[model samples]
Target: MKKIFFAFIVTLGIFEVHAQKEFQGMAVYESKTSTADMKNQMGKNKEITPEMQKLIEERMKGMFEKIFVLHFDRSSSVYKEEEKLDAMGGQGQGGMRMMSSMMGGGGTFYKNVKDKMYSVDKEFMGKEFLIQDSLPQLQWKMESETKQIGGYTCYKATASKPVNMSDFRNFRPKDQSKEAGKEEKKETEKKTNFMDDFELPKEILITAWYAPEIPINQGPENYWGLPGLILEVSDGKTVILCSKVVMNTKEKATIKAPKTGKTVTQKEYDEIVMKKMEELREMGNGPGGFRGMRMGR
Candidate 1:
């Protein structure tokens, strides 16, 4: 009886130690560059790239859109809730709404990720890779440059992507009005945009910060794989930061994928998305064009 009690206490202690070991940190990102055209009161016809012309025609083929942001830690990962924002007003809403609609309704909201143990070995592109299932299978190397961010020492890393605009496909809304006149349908067709392919950005740079006091490796928004917690990530002009950090808390932490969207490859989706945006722009005015549609009435 004494031996059994001793063994039980030992096992319990092991479980507690494992449970307390978790990596958590906050990340923040700020917009540094955007490629959208920002002009006012221009002529009706403007010559665009052949690529832009193609995007104008493919805008009429889909019913839903979604934007996904990934998050990661060393051992496990969780996809945070995705929300859609209305892009009609030139607002900063990305593809979150269309994705939410495709999932049925609402969005997935989570407090944090909860993985206790993670494998240290993983492979990517035939190379020995860091074992992070929650992050993309891309390469990252540390740079000599260093700086202080959010009060933590950070190192710079760079990642690059070729131009590939294939992940957007939910922007086009088809005509549903059966009793509408033929002229209206014709007009919609004339305003449509189509694309043959999408392009990827030229490069991405990440400047990550790690907290030496925190022993676990984790950070916000699909970033991991450093000796310490990363508090910031950036790609050229785009930057994300961590506003909060928690080492060990008593609350139960659960990490799971959100069910609020349809699954799609990035390439197949962005192609449709870019085209639909162009089509909407070609509508001359906004969705229910009254601001610019009437001349003398």
Candidate 2:
């Protein structure tokens, strides 16, 4: 597996040199993260009402059920949401509607597999940010497994990533007060942090299925550098599957890198997003928490 990992990395460099002869195509990936597992796990929490738990679980389930497009021409590609909303709804309405949009928007993500660099066009609240960083160097262990997706044969590969529960900040209830924050944290810690596995596993498995027929080392998100194009991704709770692939068309793709926004690395962007959610939590808690959902503040 380690040998295959090193070989794939070297192969990416070779593909970069022959980019002029590579195929240019587009793929559509529909992502759906199951809520059943999380819903069952949320049942054990005593601090949250059944109603609030259900709301949280449902919101999370919807967040990942979005559509994304990947336009790749050899070493470079852009992966971004299909439904690019022009305006965030109900901005001054001052309700969960605005906050929901704030928490729900999945930003535009771009990757240059040859350079091993990534840029994400993200909008938090009203502020825009350009998240610039290198792609994660995942050591994927090739498995002697195969699957067929959209008529293309795919091979399986798996790797482990360090788990951080803090990444799911949008799903967390807005902090209303200091006491409320502690109580909220205590409750979440008791039953598992926003889902099962709050105990913090050293690492979580990331499984990817890629089709060698498509020679580009690109995928729906920042996942690339594999021997082929990735079609499916699984992270225990969330699963993103490719439903369609379109190639060799007369369509012009705008796969350019985003330039406008405050510049920040991936880590800095994450910190900014999390901080905004925390502020929203306080806002929601201010006037009796999300229309009587009981923020535990």
Candidate 3:
């Protein structure tokens, strides 16, 4: 009955909001990065060859260009990728696995303002993890700045958080992990072997522009708690910007939490990933003898 009622409401173009003119609809975001900027960031790296550099840059441009959708009503929203198996220029898989996690890649994100809880589907080392966590409380400072994105007037807000290199890549470098473990620690403190190995930056700042006209506090990937719908988000190196919005359209969709993964809180998921990654590193480090012993752990 509830589903039928929602269908009827969608038919009438009304769901939750009383103001018919107000937006209770969907927004499409195309996340893009400046290829030139990426090429520049890579200029300092010693690992990429000049020939490999050209191929990798083209691959980066092809891969990072993505589409995300925001299906929002008054107080709830679900953001996910619009699936497309893009051509990767027929390039072979590179030395590293996908860096999508750094890109905030494919995850069904469900947010509820009333409940103040969020869930994300994260895949790590062939395991799908359902991460349930309390909504991040961001201390945002709204500015007098304004801009127009996809025909909507937007206001600016800024916040910052600590960041880590592992947060951007699927796996931590085996050498980096070893170095982190060498640091001394107090035995009384909970061991950070699985946790502290990855190095983190002092901070990452987020600058987002939201549309007050829309009035939905939602945005791509874990960014929310704003007064309006977030249209563009920047984290220094990457940016997710809303390219299109369809207000009150007949595209039938529902926002729901994901199921059927190893259910875990965010902290537990991180620990599990580290344990698996360590196993992989150890397995690769071996004559298959010490590797087997470590795997037994």
TM for every model, in the order presented, reads 0.47, 0.70, 0.70
lDDT value for model 1: 0.39
RMSD of candidates 1 onward, in order: 13.3, 9.5, 9.4
| True lDDT of residue 176, candidate 1 | 31
lDDT tens digits by residue: candidate 2, 189-242? 533234222233456789999999988789977788788889999877667899
The full ranking of all candidates by lDDT, starting with the best, is 2, 3, 1
**Cα lDDT computed for each candidate against the true fold:** 0.39, 0.66, 0.66
Task: Give the residue spans of candidate 3 off by over 4 A.
Answer: 1-23, 34-47, 86-98, 164-166, 169-199, 274-297
Which candidate has the highest lDDT of all? 2
Better of 1 and 3 by TM-score: 3
lDDT of 3 by residue, 249-290 (tens): 676577778875788887687666556556755555311112
Give the Cα-based TM-score of candidate 1 against the true structure: 0.47
Q: Candidate 3, 208: how far from true, in Å?
A: 1.0
Candidate with maximal TM-score? 2
Q: Which whole-number lDDT from 0 to 100 does residue 14 have in model 1?
A: 90
Ranking by TM-score: 2, 3, 1
